[model samples]
Target: MTKSNNSATLNLQYGGGFRMSSVIPVIRKFNRFYTNVLGLLDQHLLETDFSLSEARVLFEIGHTDRCTAKMLIDKLRLDAGYLSRILKRFEEQDLIYRIQSDEDRRLYYLRLTDRGRDALAKLDARSDDQIRLMIGHLPEQAQRNIAKNMAAIENALSDDPQIRQEVRIRCDLKPGDVGSLIHLHGWIYAKECGYNHVFESYVCQTFVDFFKHYSPDKDRFWFAEAGDEIVGAIAIVGHPDRRAQLRWFIVHPEYRGLGLGKRLLQESLQYSKEKGFRRVFLETTEDQKTAIAMYERAGFRKIAEHENHLWGVHHIEQTYELQLP
Candidate 1:
């Protein structure tokens, strides 16, 4: 009998009344790729004594000076025992050190040694060079296509309810990320809110120009990323009058209706209050009924109205103000 080369062979039977299991074959193929081709399974088998898992733990420790075991478990999703073994192996190598928490002796904190830091840095450099070599072979459009497809797959996976429950919002706001927030907001308004490109373009330009004249220390931006993809964002810029101007609030269409937008708004307001702002204000079109309502519910009151040319006509721009407690 001859072995079949047809793609449809995956669905055919190799035995009596029993179809061949495709899963095992696929897993084996992946194992071969990761072990032989990618050289990930035991790439450092002779060069280094650490397993892949141990190397990963060292990498995480090198990135942050102080991290608790719980933080590492949460970030990597590794089983407690598995992570413990890896930690122990690194400790034996004197590559990492752990200390018991003074407050809770049961809790352990981990940090990398100088040797571990140097090792992790070399690993990062090697990984970067490897990716650059592989991606360099692809054309610009092909690379973009890979990025788009990967993003779509990631967003789809994050939509799972089980995964959503584990997602956490990050509070740190960095400069230049405000531009990303502005882009997201404009894109959401144009796509989900059914506005035209004119409104989005104008709003984006307004945000860019506003950030240029204003210092970022006086301004704040926040973003929510689920496994490295930006799902939502918001920003508050300081007005010359000492008021916090809320702007560029947006949640991706995939993440909307999940209360992420409300969360971002609440956090932004809280950050503004902490920064010594007495009052907060924002402007939105009358058509943004849901957003306007949310602002009102959050103690913001409509103070004035104006015309917005970006709306392509005379659109009512409602300004909402909230007094910080």
Candidate 2:
């Protein structure tokens, strides 16, 4: 069969670049596979009378506080006319009711009737059963990995601030923490700065050196984790003469804007002060403008900088120092 004009236009738009064209097929394949896996192509959802969209509407009405049609439209990106018809059907079936607002006569709030709640509970049970059956044969670790990957996908695509996961900061170093931090540095720097594998080697070497003289009383490491994943990290490596050096300071790009970097920085600086360090300093490259701005704001002043041909690139290496009061 011949391709349609719309398909031809899409090919023209995306086919020019290898990177763009490659991603399109992968995403489309995932969309098709997921729809089949979830039985989303069925006329009704999970053997229920409600269509997928209608079931989602029921779920929101049952769970949301003071739900409204406008809220549904915004949350689901559903067309207004389509949602209106769904709500009307629910009303006719005695599954939902609306109450006019006391202060605003024109505004009405949607609430699930008793029958609606029962229907929603049934849908929820079936969904849980379906998911359990799908993943029941997998090992426990495999199940957890699937969950983590799903969360990562959601966090990557979601623009809603509320969807971002909560990150917790801890100073305890686990068995694989060092390796994970090194991986973060290597992967993030390579992607963000086009750094070669030499940069990863440098990071690995630093950890090796840090472990040689590892002093638990004087040194500390902070890891910002979301669920089981380490998203940011920093460390205070104690030195002679009451000095300390901040090292391995990195944040994953997906978790950067959530104040995690600032939290990690403050934790390290506070620990340095508690350990009676007179000065703390950190080294970074000139290409890290955002991190440099954060350092300056944290009372660190640029003390030294020089052109260095390290990390497979020729760039200005900078040192910023903060003095303890």
Candidate 3:
């Protein structure tokens, strides 16, 4: 059966039935196992005098730019009184200091003291060492599986029903951005789609042409980021006659099968529409059957085709065009 191209149509079943009722114990079991593995039940985390909650407070203080008691309360969802006691403990130990906000005297901002930084540093190192010791003996693949599963759990359990939180989308480009995207295209296509260096060169040349006539107001590119890495990309480059070309649509194999491709395509099409492009079109080889199918589902029709072997592959290059509303 053919699945819907729109990700919103892919529903995850939910209920309070026997199957759902049975899942709680299994989830709790995994939670217990993980907590034990991390030694969270220990009176002191990483053999430090601080409890897990206290260590987490310190870690949050160290990482946050605008540290505040209220922010911590909101983030940790801790009782005001409980957080106040923790703050008092930190102050007594000279781990953190507070300064009154200039605009609001009652609003105090938390800052880590030298002692606090040192303690946090030790806690960070110890936590890293602990995880290393736990996973060090496992094979590299096993280690990756653990990390991947962890991400999957977070994405699945998020309060938002949409899968969008699993990836970040941005239209802004900075220095070295194009090079990184081009490199991603080169490596990902080479590894997964059986494309070669010649294809990479073609990608480079396309970017070169793109930059030569780049316009921020009319042309736009979207990047899909997952955990600090760019996993997918799509671009809409404006042309004459109210037309726009979609280009550089690719997603990393590790992050595929997660609706990122559909989302990226939708973003590009939306941008093209906003840019007043009456027609949106893309050039792709027939080997990209899956992407072609998605385009077809999204109302794109094959406008032209040509036999091309320029990218070290003998394939029919197809031009798919979609009329915008």
Candidate 4:
């Protein structure tokens, strides 16, 4: 079946289960509210002669490298005929020009003229001014929260990999880092491992215990962040006899497969070695095959396993240890 038909059939089958009757209205309301807030319903955008779609096309042409009609169509999901007309108008207005690609004679590259750049700049300034006017009265924290939430929405809806690549890794623990990490552990484990609130309580207690003897010289935390959000984290806890334990290593699900988990683990191991810890070990369940493989590749050998009835599940708890040279 075609994609649209398949989607329709799936929606019919699962729509009730997902409570679409309630969810659909909420989404539609948000769409209407956002469009109105941005004055997208107006014939002209930002009081300019350019329509909303025309302004977007102009902006993308200016910013995108080696822009083309095909790229615009794919990025914006615009109709070919509509986009062609817009491009034709832009050419007539001397706002844009096209050049044939040397490698492909039939393929043409789009570029914005000086006038087009000026138009886009005006649109950008207007957009910024509109947003500033909307949120400028809010507290500084509220403004920051707005931007962070918007980034989150974009990350959830966008197919662009660039959003995931903007993660920053840091070793400093801030005021709310532990609480956020605990929340992440609870949410991620429940979603991925069917763990219950008991598991979350266990994580909380672990942090409580870790803090009892937390030494700045011995313990280290590495957090991978995007904007004001923590997407991944790892920590190494010092123990007696020059031994250390790697704990609380995790990456947000959406931020995985970007080598973030590997980076966090490496940071912990390197910190362990730098602290002159002779042995580094970690405890994890056998169900975590991906993490287990990563541990093995990092020269850790599984030395122990036991059946455990905890976290609302039956699982084999395993210990892996690495001896540093």
Candidate 5:
């Protein structure tokens, strides 16, 4: 949490041979797209003779209270000789001045001159203007979606855990909500269970069936949102005999231990009760140990099961029932 330890370090394990997922090409494509976007914006960096790196140095020097060359070296991880040259240039240009530290005369602190402040202000304005122009035509909601997705990508790849807080649940579907959930299901299951196209096809078919049997008043689909992104979901669909079927229950791998699964399960059960359902049931796989454990702890009894090879794996199909008073 402290700035000193904010940088992330990842640990990876490599096998002698491993099969890369089909998603790698798509990820590389997005990487190219994002790289281009940044390249476009970078065309308008600091207008002075300073390169972008030099401008960054100036900004950090201006902001850090007790800026020193050692701090800059550690923070930026730049070659000390190269940074000393940049600082020398700034001094020659009258943009920054150094003062001797009172306690340690050998160490000098950096400060921006009046001209340096003006230059920094101009650089900041230009950066903001470029971003505004880039996303100006997008609707507000679309802009938020872009921002949220970008943050999600950053968080997924980050070694440090994302800022934690209570996740929020919304019980309504938006335009692209179903599509995102389907994609999450496909991606997560493929990674976790070795599931392939057959599983995705089954999920698509379920969505189609859901549309055909949809009843708004008696059914609920809850999305667990955290950090402005959909991370988990569960649903309770009404059936005859005062029963409800829980469907499409999932929690993102990155957010599994945050109580999101339990919260979503609680919400689904509560909603089924509110809808006057006397019994609640769900179908899951034996491989879903965490979810099954939660169900058992919540008083769900396994009523039926069969063995079969589906979703690219040999797993048991289980049906769990919970009697609701």
Candidate 6:
């Protein structure tokens, strides 16, 4: 109906998609922090005669020995020409060795030399120390809070079987990301259960508080990623009373109806069993019937039913428990 713009047809066929400008600035900020503020680039340039790109290659090889050249290309998504140039530079520097795999002569695998290993250690220590310093600036409680929020953010952007190119799970959560997760959760719950305005700040804050106080070594969080995007998550926290608490179980709306929630619950349950937990427990509202059914399917039995006047007058509460093997 309307006249076209300067570009070609704006149809979805050609993969013309919407772009978020906010992400670019954040990436640029981190780039500056690593190169200019942290002096990471300067450190590598001064200590070794290697450029930043070469240093990254060496670090990757040092951390994961015998990685194929194709592996790096796929993982890092680097341009073949650029990667080849960096590999050649590292090869010239004697920091890495490349060999044709015995089984596949066409496949070139890379290994870091002793010098490269030493360099990676230096980089790891410097990065860890810097992160520790930053965390140390906050109080212990605040550090834990940051770590939990960071973990949520990481879970949201994870790139595993659950999803790809999304949020990262199994990482430290940031300050604002949990709120974002809560907001995102609201949309998912609304879409899935036809319950609008159900997930709020109180629920998000409650789960965030639990994660911040809980010890991860005693517990673990499972998340699903679709193309590096965190579309689902499940947290299992072990209490001193020998009980495992399931909290903040959620999945993004785009990934719903795929049985991912069930898969995550199964994984958490198996993990709980492996960790020697005798039982797992969770709380939900009457409004979330599907989730309640999912819990039941996961072998969770209703342990308690009550009314909650604390949050709202119409709130009906139910607690479910699963006995672990």
CA lDDT of each candidate? 0.73, 0.88, 0.83, 0.90, 0.84, 0.70
Q: Which ranges in model 5 have alpha carbons more than 4 Å from their true place?
A: 1-130, 133-146, 157-168, 226-229
Task: Please give the ranking of all candidate structures by lDDT, highest first, separated by commas.
Answer: 4, 2, 5, 3, 1, 6
Q: Show model 1 residue runs off by greater than 4 Å.
A: 1-151, 154-159, 165-168, 171-179
Better of 5 and 6 by lDDT: 5
Model 6, residue 322: C-alpha shift (Å) = 12
- lDDT tens readout by residue for model 5, 44-107: 6734566777878988998899899998888777899999999999999899999999999898
**lDDT (10s digit) by residue, model 4, range 181-287:** 99999999988899999999999999999999998899999999999999999999999999999999999988989899998898788888888999999999999
Give per-residue CA lDDT, model 1, range 89-194, as digits (tens): 7788778888888888887778888888887887777666666776889998877776665566555756345445334677576565656665776667665556
RMSD of 1: 10.8
- Model 4 gets an lDDT of 0.90
- Which pairs in model 4 have colliding backbones? none
What order do candidates take by TM-score, descending?
4, 2, 5, 3, 1, 6
Winner by lDDT: 4
Q: Which stretches of candidate 4 lie over 4 Å from their true place?
A: 1-21, 40-46
lDDT of 2 by residue, 1-325 (tens): 2448657756766677557666777689678878887574343363678888898999999999989999999999999999999999999999999999998999999999999999999988877777787899999999999999888888888877766757778888899999999899898988888888998999899989889999899999998887799988999999999999999999988887888888889889999999999999999999999999999998999999999776777889899999998
Q: Which lDDT tens digits does candidate 3 get at residues 100-177?
A: 889998888899999999999998888887778778999998898788778678665664445434678898997777
Better of 2 and 3 by lDDT: 2
RMSD of each: 10.8, 5.8, 12.7, 6.8, 10.2, 11.0
TM-score of each: 0.51, 0.82, 0.55, 0.85, 0.60, 0.48
Candidate 3 to truth, TM? 0.55
TM-score between candidate 6 and the true structure: 0.48
lDDT of 6 by residue, 76-182 (tens): 77889999988887778777888888998888789887876777787777667767765787888878776666656554565644432334445345465555567
Error of 1 at 149 (Å): 4.5
